[model samples]
Target: MITCKDFLSELNEYLDEDCRDEVRKELEEHLDECPNCWVICNTTQKTIEIYRGMDPIPIPVGVHDRLLDALRMKSQIAPPA
Candidate 1:
């Protein structure tokens, strides 16, 4: 049986349908048995769908810089030299 950690680790590949057949089967089984994971997967899939259906919008330059700065700080990544 796959654990939540396993599910999360493979989530992107699973959603992209890029995993091997065996791994896909295990992930599906995990989703079936774990309601929390199921909801997370479902919500993420729906979010992807909604975003895909929308026209791409450009973020303002200041906001984009701020967002990147915030993410870098949160992840403890140094800004590019």
Candidate 2:
């Protein structure tokens, strides 16, 4: 049997259709019996849908270059593997 914690942990992958059939079935079963988890799942679904519905904005000019330079600096400062 699946539990609420398991469902939440797998929620992102499940919604992305990335989980295996067995795991997906387990999550579905848990959702069937758990009202609180079900509400969480529903709310997450709605939030994702709303975000998807919004128009995407373009990245500000030079943002990518600035980000890459910052990342390179940070990497240089980090200890060697």
Best by TM-score: 1
What TM-score, computed on C-alpha atoms, does each candidate reach?
A: 0.64, 0.63
C-alpha lDDT (0 to 100) for residue 45 of candidate 2 = 89
For model 1, the run of ten residues with the poorest summed lDDT: 11-20
Which has the greatest lDDT?
Answer: 1
lDDT of 1 by residue, 1-81 (tens): 999999999988899856788999999999999999999999999999998899977999999999999999899999999
Candidate 2 stretches greater than 4 Å from native: 56-81
How do the residues 2-75 of candidate 2 rate in per-residue lDDT, one tens digit apiece?
77777899999888857788888988899899999989999998999999899987888699768867887988
Q: Write down the RMSD of all candidates, one decimal each.
A: 13.3, 12.2
**Clashing residue pairs found in predicted model 2:** none
